[model samples]
Every structure is written in structure tokens, then in C-alpha cells.
Target: MPASRCGAIRRADASENIWCMTEPSAWRRARAFSRGPESTGHRLTRRRRARMRRLAWVLLAGAALPLHAQNPVEVDAQHYRLEYEDKQVRVLRFRLAPGEKSPQHEHAARITVVVSGSRLRIEDTDGAIYEMTIYSGHAERQPATRHTVENVGSTVYEELTTEFKDAASQPPKLVVKAPPPPPPPPKKEEPKKAEAKKKEEKPKEEKPSVAASAPTTPGAQPAGTKPAATGTTTPTPAQAPAAKVQPEVAAAAPPPEPQPIIKPLKVRPPEEPNRRRRKSFAAEEMSEATVNNTRLAFMEQGKGQTVVFVHGAMGDYRTWQLQIPEFAKRFRVVAYSRRYHYPNPSTGKEEDYTYEANVRDLAEFLKALNAGPVHLVGHGYGAAVATLLAERHPEMVRSLVVSEPGFDKLLDEKRAYRSHWARDEIYNIIRKPLSRQNPENGVRVYHNWLAETQPWQQIDPQEQYERMQNANALRAQTVDPTAPAFNCEAAKKIKTPTLVVAGQNRSPNSAEITGTLAACLANSERVTISEAGPAAYLDNAKEYNDAVLSFLGKH
Candidate 1:
């Protein structure tokens, strides 16, 4: 073959073609090259074959390139730091100096919170470039993307980002709007004239009253009945209507006017047995109390001794949907949303989102109610607040019922460490999702981790919506650094009648904390609700209510 043709084929097939050309005999190569005058046809075929092989190799190499690159933290270590990570989410802190550009990287769906304002230029994989102006404290949710970032402004750009690891856990875009009013009930139709006349003519027969027909004395038989050998009396046929009335008088009376027949209204089928309906209180039924300069929304029912329900993080007065109705039958029931919870305006201050603040609010709330010392029932974080209140102002509390109080500080050194570790684990799992402004996913992660069963899926949609409304409070509590410590010494001081309730299937950390509290309280009794976890009241409402009510009755 000619030098140019041999060189092109060698480059295309590499060593194999070169070895074949060099090893072949000189005569054989000459014969193959001299197929025709200048071997034009042979040369053209070889060139086409070589080009096809080269194209195939190029395509294969292109296929080897990755569609998505490594994580941003791995690709740009100088600008990104892995702050936290778990199966559900990964949190990273990023900072870029002025005019600094980062290599292309990949990120999952994430929520970015701007720590410092700056102008940024983003270049996507498809070569699309966009400039964005961001401000400090601004947060926005982003979908999974591959891009390169550059700080185009004069100042450095900094942000904290939470990337969702599970696509299903991504927060949904929520739109707020008033729900449409329910449809009007179907109207009833009037009975036809013929049907009304038939019903009117079918007169109801008159029968003697039992009191008039029965014998007045015991063991006495009626005039038409005869006693049997077995001491059972057999009655003859009922007496015939008296024939004293004249036929002419009866025929003269006009037939009673046709009366309409009323049919029973149709009712919708009952919902699933496990599904709970949303409980709504009328405007007149709900009342508000300003406590500690915060307007607390509350609902009250029944009349007697006052029993106030304090809800935990991510809950409002509606958390006691089950308890309120059951308790209201007897003692007066009051369930109020704490400060920053749903239906209440949030000051957005970190200091107002602690247990101490909650306890102070509860004390002031009780004073405002002026219902005397009231029975206090609290759950989760609220349970801790209830205990603190009892310790600080025993005079304001009649009795205390705390279910699964999350006072990890009260446990022994070993148990406290384990509790803290578990808490951090859970926080890591939910922090990213919560930061993404997706309360529903946060709620799902937290509850799914706390219990073996899927509590989030089992709850009513209205209840889920209610929890999402208080998600900000939960987020604040999770990151609060000034959480008040509750040692056993404080628990020992609470001498009020107390019931420490826990779930039989509660997490080990929760069980330890609650058990420690129970051990420290001098006048406290502990009860466990079966088939329940951290949210015993929701898991087994009847059992939880009975236990709480039984405890309240004594105090």
C-alpha cells in the first residue's frame, strides 16, 4: 500500500495494522497494492473502512464520559465544606472570594440560604449563563442541576445549602389560598299527589294501650286469655272494634287531607377507620388570651375544673383533637397554641423559641385565664415546659401529666450522651429537608425516625397541614443553642401530683429521659401506653386518654 494510505490506516487501527503491514512479505504486499493500474478502487475502500473504525472508536470514548460530575464538595473543596450528612440529606457551607470561579459540579435538589449578598454568574452544563443578585438572609429552593458558579461581585459570596439525597423527600411547592366552601346538600323532592292520598287513606290502626289492656294485679289473666298447664297464659284473638258507631256518621266525615311523606336524608359514607377528620371550632367557640405580650389562640369547652393542654413542637391547640372532646365531657378543657405556633404571629426571634420562654408563657396564660390552679397536660417539648412550670410556680398548677418529656439533660451521664447522640442523628436526617422550607418532608423524617410505624402517612391531611404551619417553631428549636438544662435536682423539687407517661414502644433515648424524670419526681407515677411510640396520644388515643384521665381524677 502507498505510504499515505498505510499511515492513515495505522493511525486508525493503531499497532495491529502497523504490525500486519510490516510482517507481510514484500511480494505479497506489492501484489495487494497492484490490484489495478493505480489501485484507485482498493485505496478508496480502505479509506472508507478506516474512517468507519475511527468514528466507532470516537463514539465509544464519548460514551465513557459521565453525565453528572462528582458532588460539589468533592470537586471544589476550597469553596465548599461538608457540614453535615445523612441518608436523607446533605448540608454544605459554601464561600467564594470575589471574582473566583468554581469547576463544574453536580448537586441534588437543595435549599440555599444566603449568608452574604453578592452578584453571581452561573454557567450550566448546556452552556447557558445567567446572572443573579442575592441578598443576605434570602432563601430559595433549587432543583437538581449541574453548573459552575462564579462570584462576579466585588464582595465574597457565602451561603448554607441543604441538598436532599432522596428525591421523594424533596419539599413540594406550596400555594396558600382559601379552600372553597363545601357544596350545598341535595334538596328533597315533594311526594306526588297520588302517593300522598294513598298514604292518607291507609289509616293507622288504633290499639289499646298496654296499661289499659294489662291486668292491674300480679298473676291476673285478661278476660279473653286462659291459663295453661305450664303456667304460660295463651291469649285469644284481640278484641274486635266496637260496633256501636253508626255507619252513616262514619261515611259523612270527609277523608283527612292528604299528608306528605317525609323521607330520611341520605348521609355520606364514613371515612376510613384510621383516618381522622379535621376538627374545626366556630368563631364564637374560639377565644384568645394575650399572655407575655403574645396573643395566644385557645379553645375551651365544658364547665368545671380547668384542664389545660400544652402541645409540643410542630403542634398547635388542634393537637389535642382527640383529647379535647373526651376531656370536655367532664372537666373544663382548654387547649391553646403556644407562642410562634400556628394561628399565632411569630416574632421570628430565636430567644422566644425556648423551653424557658414557653414556661413563662404558660404561667402568664394560666394567670390570664383566672380559672384557679388547673390540671396541666403536655406532650413532647411541651411536656418539658410543663415540668419546668410546675417547678417554678407550683401554686398555679393543680396536677401535671407529661407524656414523653424530651429532657435528655436529666438522664445519667451515659444515658445523656446516648440521648444527645440520637438527637443529633435525627437532627441531621431532617435538618436539610427542613432547611429546604419543606415542613411536610421534615415532619415525615422526624416521625418516621422516632417510631417504627409510619406515623406521617397515617395522620389526616388536615393534621399534617396543621403540623406544617408550626414547622418554623420546630426549626428554631432544633438550632437553638440556649436550651435550658433540666437536671434531676429540678425534677426533685417538683412536688405537685404528677403523671409521667410514656409509650411502650418509644425510642430508647425518649424512654430513658422519661424514666429519669419519673424517678426524680417524688410524687409522680409512671404509666405506659401500649402499641404506642413517642406520640402515644395519637397512636392509641383511648388508652392514653384513660391513663391521663385516671391520673387527673386523683389529683
Candidate 2:
């Protein structure tokens, strides 16, 4: 038989053996041979047919499998185990023994927390190789990748990885190009052209029939009538009568006046009722004031009497975000991020990161604002600053609100000694982590201690992120020896209508310090906010705010 009669057969260039039969004749012949008798030739044909059918099914099954099934866990089950999975994220526990190598696998963008130290070699599909030494308890974020990992160290390499599914996981290859210009507007037709179009569209009139000219009786056929056919053919354009041409008087009409372009007005969306949009505290929203050649960032709102808020260590103007709107409703509120805090350039010198320097800055800041005798509020380290400022520059302060001031120097000899010993112990605990270049762990320990909480992991993630922004400042403060000492004498001099606020559940040290300061002040009253910790304002903002507002209203 010729090739056309038999149809064509082609071999596919695939890993799997695939035969393509182009016509129904080839399929019919194969099916017939398979169903034929068990002779030598028949058996051979039947066996070949069965093999092709099996191959076809195998190909379809492979195609049906999901692409994501080729992830690390499924590719190398021995090295990777699925720990947790949800729509937003997938967590996996991975472990590779000494001298062990894993098959090439893919991973989404993930954060890996190392559980054991190891030296490893990684090879990517693109032929690039990387060697790294990772430490136990170290964590880092990695872009989505496909690679083979081999542990070359003497111990097992183990890590817990959380892969993000919500965000773009793959590493980006950026290209810069100018945007394409917009398309031009459509052309409008002129009045003369529009008039000529109308004239061409006029319908033609038909000639009168001969039967109609010779009037016929009712229901009677005319002399020239013919029987009705299935259909009638109209005259072609060449056979049709010529159309009449109109005079040029219509085209002589003047064009109408140009119409004005009407533009749409933009209307703003209505804001949600009873909901105040919180400030983002972005760079643009911040106002800068230079005090003694040092630029400080602050946020101000409202009017009337001024109330200045100074944040402590590990915080910025954003710390008072909860209080700013509430206070601004009644008084002029100004909250500033102290020196060496987040979003501000720092000298990184330990000596400059002291409470005394902060006090000097506050004094100058008040003078620059010229908001005479303003209400002052401070927390933690900032509380000490406010106290020192009031004592030194009495004219600058109207009323003072100090919430659990960390001024150990105001304590008597025995209490001061105990405070120093506790401080040394804390430094000892954080020293190793800082030396290991993991400041987060150090900050965690310090934060837990100050918050009087056992575990730092329970803290809000947003708060943690904001606090980490000032990790450098925390490090500087940790090592600084020039921290200001505010004694009883200094506290006695600050008779600026002081309101010392303390948390009901505050640590013993904080209670003692706050009590001592309150006793030292000649004209001062003390109040405690219940269900709070060292940071009374943050822990119980409503009660703290009400207490402070009541005190401010009195003065």
C-alpha cells in the first residue's frame, strides 16, 4: 500500500516512547490485530498494541499529577518532613545527616530557623555553587530557589523553615524601561463630509407598473400578469435606473459653533464613621526641629495648651500613637522620638547616649517651640529626663507626668547597690548573644525583663518590628557608663506640679523607685493604673490617660 492509503506514523522526541498514528485506519488495524487469533504473527501484533496502550495511559497519569507535588518534602522525604501547612504558609522540618546529600528540590521564599550548626555545600541547577557555615539558633530569610544541599560537617544539619504562599516567592529579575505613550484620540468628521454622506444615503423611487396605469376590477388579474414563482431576482446595479443628483445649496450651510469639552469631577470616598485613621508615622509626616545642632523628629496635633510626650529606649514617636489622638482632642499634643531613636541619624557614640544629654535636648526643644510652661509627659528612661529637665529648667515645665521612672540613682545606698547588681546580671546574660552578632536574642531578654514578662515571643509582632528598628540605640545604651544619676536632692527641687504614675502590677524595683521619687518631691501626688506593667501607659492606656488628664486639668 502507498503511504497516503496506509496513513503516516511518526516517532515523538520525548523521554517516553511515543508513537503517533495520524489516521483512523492505523488505529482500526491495531485494534483488529489485537482481537485476532493466537498465531505467531497475531500474538506479536497484540503484544505491541498492548505496550502502546500502556504507554499512552502512563503519559496521561504523569500529566494529571500536580506541579507543586515536586516540592522539597515530596522530592526528598528522608530530608524534609511537612510540619504544618495552611493557605498562607507551609512549615517544614529538614534534617540532613553527616556526609549526606539531598536530591535537587524546589522551595518557596522562606524563613529558616537553624536548630543545629553545620557546614554545607549547595549547588543550583544553573551550575552555581555556594558554601556556608550556619550556627545553631540562627535564622534568615531566603528567596524561592531550586538546589541540591550536601552536609559536609561531622554533625547533622537541622532547620525549621516556614514558606510564604501569599507573596511572590520567586526572586525577581528587574528591567528598567520608560512607559509607552498613550494612543491618540479618534479623528472627527467635518460638516461638509457629513452632508455628502447624508445625500448618498437617500432611497431610490420605483417606476409605476403598466397594470396599475390600466385600472383593474377588484380581485381580477391584469392582461400582462404572470403566475407567482418561488422567488424574484432584483435588478443588478448595472441594470438599475440612475439616481438623481441634489443641488450644492445644502453643503453651503455654515458649520455649527464648537462645543465645550465636559470633564468629570472627582469625588472623595466618605470616611468610616467613628473610626480615626491612625498616622503611618512615615518620613513625610514627621516634623524636624534642630535643638543644639541635633535634628529631632516630632509629631504635633491639636491646639491650646501644649503637652509634650517623650518616649523611652526602644521606642519612638510611634510609641505614643495610642495616646496622641486622645490627648490632641483636649490639648495640643507633641510627641518626639528621642535622640539615637529610630528614623534618626545617630553619632553611635556611647557618651552621647545618656539621659543628661537627652535632658539638654529637651530644654532646647521647649525653647525652640516657645510653648511656654508646657505639660510634660515621659515614660521609663524618658521619665528620668523629664524629671531632670524640670529640676534644672523649672520655667519650661507647667506640670509633669512621670510613669515608672528608671532612676536607680534616686534610691538609697542599699537599694542602689542591689539595682547595680541586677543590672550587671542582665548585661552578663545578653553579652554572649551580642558578641555572637545576634542582637535580637539580646533584645528579647532585655524586653522580657523590662516588661516583667517571662517570654518575649508573646509580644505583638508589629511592636517587635518597631522595637527592632531601634536595636542599634539599645546596644549603645547597654554599654554606656555615663548614664545620668538623679539623686534625692534633684528630685526635691522638681516641685513643678508632679504626678507620678505607677502600675499596680509593676515589679518591686519599679515600685520602690517610683515611691522614693514621689516621697522626694515636695508637691507631688502618686496614682497607680491597675492591670498594668512597667509601661503603665502602654499596658493600660485608657486608665493611664484618664489619670494623667485629671491631674493636668487640676493644674
What Cα-based lDDT does every candidate model obtain? 0.66, 0.65
Name the 10 consecutive residues with the lowest summed lDDT in model 1: 261-270
lDDT of 1 by residue, 56-120 (tens): 99988765432224567779999999999776778999987554689877777889998765668
* Residue runs of model 2 more than 4 Å from their true location after superposition: 1-284, 347-351, 428-438, 452-454, 481-483
Q: How many backbone clashes does candidate 1 have?
A: 0
Best by lDDT: 1
lDDT (Cα, 0-100) at 433 in candidate 2 = 59
- Model 2 over residues 118-189: C-alpha lDDT tens digits? 668897766667888776679999987777899754335689999887437743333333434556853432
Report the number of the highest-TM-score candidate: 1
Task: Tell me the deviation in Å of residue 80 in model 2.
Answer: 43
What's the true lDDT of residue 544 in model 1? 96
